[model samples]
Target: MIALAGAIGTGLFLGSGKAIQRAGPVGTLIGYSTIGGLVICVMLCLAELSALAPVSGAYVRHAEYFVDPALSFAIGWIAVYGPCVSVPSEWVAVSTIVRYWTDLHPGIIIAICIVVSFLTNIFFIRVFGEVELISAMLKIALIIGLILFGLVYDLGGVPGQSRLGFWYWVEPGAFGEGYLVGGGIGRFCGFFSVLVNAVYSFAGVETTSIAAAETKNPRRNIPRAAKHIFVRVFVFYILSLFVVGLIVPSNDPHLLTSTGNAAQSPFVIAAEKAGVRVLPSIINAVVVTSAWSSGNHGILQGSRSLYALALEDKAPAFFRRTSRWGIPYLCVIFQSSFMFLAYMSLNSDANTVFGWLSNLTASSTLAVWVVVGTCSLRVRWAMEAQGIPYQELPYSAPLQPYLAHVVTWFSSFIMLSGGFYVFVDGHWNVSDFFSSYFTIPLSLALYLGWKLLKGTSIVPLEEVPVGTFIAIARANPEPPLRKKKGVVGWFGRFWWD
Candidate 1:
C-alpha cells in the first residue's frame, strides 16, 4: 500500500500535464508504457532478491553482501538523496496543489506539509503504514474514478459535452513538435522528455522492499507487493494518462501554464471545460492528499536508507539510534531538515522549482535502479557459482539476469541522455543540464573515493555468501499466506489482503 501510494503521486496527478504538453497524446502513452516496462523489470529483479533477503535497505544491503561494500556505500547515499530532494518536490507540488483553493505562500505550505509528514513518520511503523494505506486507497479510488470520468466525458456521456473520441490526438496529429528543434526531431525530443517525467512517476516501485525488515512475514509479503506494483503502475498510471490524453488536448495552453493548482491538471481542465465545475476542486483536494502522502513516503525511504547505512558502518553511528517504538528518530530528523529545500519555491516559480527538483530526483532514482539491476545480476551469478537451484529460493523472478541486463543498460542510457535537449541549438540551460547529469559524476566520485580509500574489492562470485542467507531464510520460514474467505475475502482482494 505504501509502495502504491509512493508510485502514484504528483507526477501522475500534476506533473503529467507537462508530459502531455511535451509528448502529445499518443506520445504520452508511448513514453509511459515504455518506462513502465522498464520499471516492471527492475521490480521483479528486486522482488526475487528481496524475498530472499528482506532487509531494511532492501537492495542496498543486497549490494553490500552480494556485490561490494564500496558499491553499496555509493548507492546507499544515492538512495538517501532520492527522498531528500523528492519530498521537497512533492511539497512543492503541495504548494501548487493548494493554489487551487488559495494563493497562500508556498513556504508556509511547505512548512505545514513538512510538519504533518514528519509527525506521521515519528510514530510506530504500523501508524505510518496505516496512513500510507489510507492514502493509497484514496489515490487508487481517485484515479479509477477519474479514468471512468474521462471515458464518460470523452464519449459525450456527460449531458452537454460533445464526444471527444481522440479528437485531440487527431487534430494534434498524435505527437508534439519536438522540444529544442521542432518537426521530426522535435517529436523525438518531446517523447524523450516524457521519459524523465515517467521515471519520477514510477520512482517508488523499487522502494517496496525498503521496509522488509519492519514488515511481518516480509519474505512473503514483500514479493507479493513487488509483483503487484507493475499492475498498479499499468492500471493507475498508464491508463490514467491515456484517459487524460483523450479528454484534454495536448496543445491546451493551460497545460504549460502550471499554476500548481487543479487548473494545471489535465482532468480538471477537461472537467471545467465540459461544465463539470465541482470535480476540479475534488480532484485538487485528493491530489493534495496524494502529494502529501508522497512526501511522507519519501521521508520514510530516505531515513531508512540512512539508518541502513549506519547499520553497515557506512554512516555516522548516531543515525542508528531509535525510539522505543523502533522509529529512527535521529534519521527522521536529519531527513526532515532537507524539507526546508522546498522553501526554494518561495524565491522561484513553484513550477520551475518543481521541474528542477523532479529532474534531480529522477536522475538519482535512475542511478539507484542501475545499481539494483547490477545487484540482481550479481545475485544470479552468485547463485550459479554456488550451485544453488532456483527452486530453493522463496520467490524467484523469471528471466534471471536477462531482465537485469536489459533494464540496467536502458536505465544507464536514459540517465545519460536525460539532458540531451539542453545541448541542442537554442535550448541550453546550465541548471537544467546539471540536473540531468549531476548524479553521474557524483556517484562515480563516491564509488571511486570509497574504493580507493578503503581498498575494497568486489566479492568473487563464488564467495558472495548467498548460501548463508538462503540457509537463514530456510531455517526460519514464514507461514503460508492466508486464504481469503467469503465476502470479506473478496473485499480484501481489492482494498488490501
Candidate 2:
C-alpha cells in the first residue's frame, strides 16, 4: 500500500485530466498500460535483487555492485536529487491549493509545507513509517470509494438518468483530434504525449525497495509487495482512468481548468455533470492532502538516498551521522535544506522554473528505471554463465533478461525523446527545449565526469557481484509465510496482514 501510495498521488488526482484531454480515452489507456508494463519489469527485477540483499539505497547501491561505480555515483546523487526537486514542487502545490480560499502569501504556505515535511522525517524512522502507512491507507480508501462511486454514477444511479455506458466515448469519439494536427499523426502525437503523463503517474513504483534495510522481513515481504503490484496497480490506475474516461469527454474544456484542485479533476467534472454538488469539495480536500503526502514521501526517499550515498563514500561524511534512534539525522537535514526552492512560487514565473525541474525529475527517474534493467541483465548473465540455477535465487523474475532488455530500450527511448516537442517546428521555446533535453546532457556529464575522475570502468559481465549477493541472501532466511485460521486469514493471505 505504501508503494501504491507513493506512485498514485497528485499525478492521478490532478494530472489525469490533462492526459484524457490530450490523448483521449483509448490513447490514455494505451499509454498507461504501456508504461505499466515497463514498471512491472522494473518491480519484478527489483524484487529479485532486493530480496537477495536488501540495502538502504536498493538500486543505487545495487548499481554500484552490479554495474559500475560511475553509474552508481550518477544514479545515487540523482536519487538524492529527485526528492530535492519533488519536495518543493509538492510544497508549491500545497500553496496553490491554499490560494482557493485565503489570500495568505504563497511563500508562507510553501515554508510551512516544507517545514512540516522536514520535521516528519526528523523524528524516529518508525514514526515516519507509521504516518506514511496511515496516509497510504487513507489514499487507498479514497481511491476505492471514488472508483465505486464513479461506477454507480456512470450507471445513472444518482440522477436516475439513462445509463452512461460508453456514451462519452462515442460522442467525443475514441480519440480526440489531439493537438488538432488533423487525423492519424495528431492522434499518434497525442498518445505519445500521454506517455510522459503515464510515466509521471507511475513514478514511485520503486518504493517497495527504496527502504529495503528497514524492512524486517525483506526477503519475503519485498517479493510479496512486488507480486501484488500488478493487481493493485491495475485496480487503482487502470480502473479509475477508465471510469474517468467513460464519464468525461476528452474535449471537455473544464479539464484544462487551472483550478489547482478537484475543480480540474475528471472525476469531479463527471460528478458535476451528473448534478452532484458536494463530491467536488470532498475530493478537493483530498487533493491537498495528496500533494502533502507526496512531499512526505519525497523527504523519506531523499534522506535515505543521501544516507546511502554517504555509506558508499560518494557523499560527505556528515550525511553518515546517525542519531541514537538510528535515524540518519544529517542526511535528512541535507535534503531538507533544498526545500527553499518552494519559495520560487512566490514569483508569477515560477511555472517556468518548476516545469524544468519536473522534466529533470522525470528524466532522472526514467534513467534509473533503465539502469535497473541494465543491472538485472548484467547480474543475470553473470549468474547464468557461472552455472548458477534459478532455483538458487531468493526471488525469481519470470522471462529473465528478455524483460530487462525490453524495458531498457523502452525507457531509454522515452528519456531521449523527452524533447520531441521542441522539434515540432514552431513549438520551440528556449526554456522548454532546455528543460526537456538538459537532463540528458547533465546525466552524461555526471557519469563521464565521475568515470574519468575516479578512473572506473564498468564491471566485466562475468565479474558482476551476483555471487556475493546470493551468499548474502542465503545467509538471511526469512520466516515461513504465516497461516491464519479464519475468513480474516483468507483476506490476510490474499492481501496483507
Candidate 3:
C-alpha cells in the first residue's frame, strides 16, 4: 500500500496538469498508458531478478552479480541520490498544499514536513509501514472515488449536473488551438512533447520492485504485487485523464493560465465543474499526504540501494551496517540528509526550480530503468551459462530476452532524445536544459571512470564468482509448499509424515 500511495502522488495530481496543457487529454492519456506498459515490462524483469535474490538492495545487487561492477556502482549511487532529491521536492510540494488551507509561511510547513519525514525514517520498519499504508490507502480511495464521481457527473446522474461526454476532445480537435503542426514531422514533435510528461507520470511504478526485499513471502507476494501494480496504475492514470478531459476543456481559462499556481490540479478543476463543493481543500490534503508518502518510500528505496552497494564493495563500508531490525542506519541518514538539501531550492521561484529539477529527475530515472533492463538481460545469459534451472525459478518474466532488449534500447533512445525537448520546445532555459539532460552522459562518464580506477572490466559470464552468482540465484528460501512437493513422489503409497 505504501508503494502504491507513493507511486500515485504529485506526479499525476499536480505535475500532469501541465502535461494536459501540452498534449491535450487524448495524447497525454495514450502516452501515459504506453509508459505504464514499459514500466510493467521493467517490473516483470525486476520481479524475476528480485525473487531469485530477495535482498534489500534488489536492483543494485542484481547489477553487481550480472552486469559490470561499475554499472552496479553507478546505479547504486544514483538510487541513493534519487530519493534524497525527492524528499525535498515532497516537502516543497507539501508546503504548497498547506498554503491552500492557510496563509502560514511555506518555510514553516517545509521545516515541519522535513522533521516529520526524518523522524519517520528514524523509527522501526513497522511504524514506517503503518504510516505509508494509511497514506497509500487514502490516495487510492480518493482516486477511485474521484473517478466514479466523474463518471456519474458525466452521465448527468448527479443532481443538477448536465451530460458532458467527449466535448473537450472534439472541440479541441485532440490538440487544442495554437498547437502548431508545421509539417508531418512537426506534428510528431508536438505529440512527443506530451509523451514525455506521460512517461514521467508512470515513473515510480517500479517502487514495488524496490520493496521486494522486505516483503513477506516475496516469492509469492512480489509477483502478485507487481501484476496488480501495473494494472492499477494504468487504469487509474488513463481513466482519470479521460474523465478530466470529458468535464474540463483543455482550453479552460484556469488551467491554461494558472501554470505556476498550487491549485492547478486538473482533478480539482474537474471536481469543481461537476459541482463538487470544497473539492480543492480535499484534493490539497490528499496531495500533501501523497507527497509525504512519496518521500517516505523514496528514502526507503534509496537506503536499501545504498546497502546493496556497500555489500558489493561499491559504496562506503558504513552503508553496509544493519541494525538489529535489519535497517541500514548510516545509508538512511546519508539519503535523508541529501533530501533535506534538496529543500534549499524552495527559496527560489517555485516554478523555475520545480520544472528544472523534475525534468532532470525524470531523465535520470529513465536512464536507470534502461540499465536495470540491460542488467536483467545479462543475468539471464549468466543463468543459462551456469546451467541454472530457469524453469524452476519462482517468478518468470514473459517474453524473455526480447522484451528486455526492447525496453533497454527503447529507454536509452528516449533518454538520449529527452534533451531535444528542451531545445525544440523553446520553453526551457539554458540552465534547465543542461541540468536536466546532462545527467545521462555525466552518469556514463562516472561509471567508466570508476571502472578504470578500480580496474574492473565487465565480468564475463564464465568469470563471475560462483558465490556471487549463487547468491542472486538462490536468495529466496524454498517455500513449504515446494518442499512438500519435492518429497511427494509415491507419497500416497508411503504415507510418511
Candidate 4:
C-alpha cells in the first residue's frame, strides 16, 4: 500500500502538467508507458532479491553482500540524499497546492505540513503503516474519481460543453514542436522530455523492497506487493493521463501556468471548462494529502536508510541509536531538518524551485535504480558461478539478468540525457544543468573515492556467498503459506493479507 501510494503523489497530481505541456497527449502516453514498462522490470528484479534477503536497506544491503562494500557505501548515501531533496520538494508542492484555495502564506502551509509529518514519524511511528494505508486509499479514490470525471467531460456528458473526444489531439495533431527546434527533431525532443518528467512520477516504486526488513512474511509479501503494485500503479497512471489528454488540450496555456494549485492541473482545467465549479477545490484538497503522505514516506525511507548505514558502520554511530519503539529518532531529526529548504519556495517561484528539486531527485532516483540493477545482476552471476540452482532462491524473477541489463543501461541513458536541452545554443541555464546531471558525477566520485581510500574491490562471482545465504534461508525457513477461509479470506485477498 505504501509503494502504491508513494508512486501516485505530487508528480501525477501537480507536475504532470509540465509533461503534457512539453509533449502532446500521445507523446505523454508513450513516455509514461515506456517508463512504466521499465519500472516493472526493475521491480521484478528487486522482488527476487528482496524476497531472498529481506534485509534492511533492501538493495543497498544486497550490494554489500552480492557486489562490493564500496558500491553499497555509494548507493546508500545516494538513497539518503534522494529523500533530503525529495521531502522538501514535496513540502514545496504542498505549499503551492494549498494556493488553490487562498493566499495562505506558503511558509505557514509548509511549516504545518512539516510539523505534522515529523510528528507522525517520531511519535506515531508504529502507526505509520496505518497512516500511509489511509492516505493511499484516499489517493486511489481521488485518481479514480478524476479519471471518471475526465471521461464524462471528454464525451460531453456534462450539460454545457460539447463532446471533446480526441478533438485536442486532432487539432494540436498529437505532438508538440519540442524544445529548441521544429518538425521531426522537435517532436523527438518533446517525447524525450516527457521521459524525464515521467521518471519523477515513477521514482518510488521500489518502496516494497525498501520496507522488506520490517514486513512480516517478507519472502511471500515482498514479491506479492511487487506483483500487485505494478499492475495497480500502471493502470492508474496510464488511465488518468489518457483521460486527461482526451479532455484537455496539450496546448492549453494553463498547462504551463504555475498557479501552485489544482488550477494548474490538466484535470482541474478540464473540469472548469466543463462548468464543474467545485472540482478544483476538491482536487486540491486530495492532492495536498497526497503531498503530505509522500513527504512522510520520504522521512521513513531516508531515516531507515541512514540507520541501515550506521548498522553497517558506514555512518556515525549515533545514527544507529533508537528509542523504545525502535524509531531512529536522531536520524529522523536529521532528515527532517531538510524541511527548512521548503522555505525556498517563499523567496522564489515555488514552481521553479520545485522543478529544480524534482529534476535533482529524479536523477538521483535513476542512479539508485542503476545500482539496484547492478546488484541484481551480481546476484544472478553468483548463482551461476557457484552452481546453485534457481530453485534454491526464495523467489525467482522471470527474464533473468536480461531485464537487469536493459533497465540499468536505460536508466543510465535517461539520467545522462536529462539535461540535453541545456546544451542547445540558446537554452543553457547553469542551475538547470546542475540539477539534472550532477548526481551522475557525484555518484561516480563517491564510488571511486571510497574504492581508492578503502582499497575495496568488487566481490568475485564465485565468492559472492550465495550458498551461505541459501543455507541461512533454509535453516530459518518461513512458515508455510496457508489458505484463508470465507468472506474475510476473500476480503484479505482483495486488498492484502
Task: Tell me the TM-score of each prediction against the true structure.
Answer: 0.93, 0.91, 0.87, 0.94
Q: Write the per-residue lDDT of candidate 4 for residues 245-289, one digit (tens) a residue.
A: 888787788876765555777867877888878888888888888
What lDDT score belongs to each candidate, Candidate 1 first?
0.86, 0.78, 0.72, 0.86
Q: List ranges where model 1 is wrong by over 4 Å.
A: 123-126, 258-261, 477-497
RMSD, one per candidate, in order? 2.8, 2.8, 5.8, 2.6
**Candidate 1 accuracy as lDDT:** 0.86
Writing each residue's lDDT as its tens digit, candidate 1 over 143-248 gives: 8899999899899999978888988888876896556676988888889999999998888888888878889988888777886877867768888988888988
Which candidate, 1 or 2, has the higher lDDT? 1
> How many pairs in model 2 have backbone atoms within 3 A of each other, for residues 3 or more apart or on separate chains, i.e. clashes?
0
Off by over 4 Å in 3: 123-126, 178-187, 211-217, 318-330, 340-348, 383-393, 425-428, 464-497
Clashing pairs for predicted structure model 3, backbone only: none
What lDDT does candidate 1 reach at residue 428? 84
If the candidates were sorted by their lDDT against the true structure, best first, what order would they fall in? 4, 1, 2, 3
Residue 54's lDDT within candidate 4 is: 86
Per-residue lDDT of 25 in model 3:
73
Model 2, 1-497: lDDT tens digits are: 66666776766776678778878888988888888888888888888888876887888888888889999999888788778877776676667656655778778888788777777777745776676677777777878888888888778787666788888778787776566466888888888877777776777778778778998889888888876865687568988898888888998888755544435678778778778778776676776777887788888788887887887788888888998888898988888898888776666444344455566667778888888898888778878888787778888888987888887899999988866777887788887777566667777888999999999998887787677878887777778887887998998676742
Indicate the residue-level lDDT of 117 in model 1: 81
Candidate 4, overall lDDT? 0.86
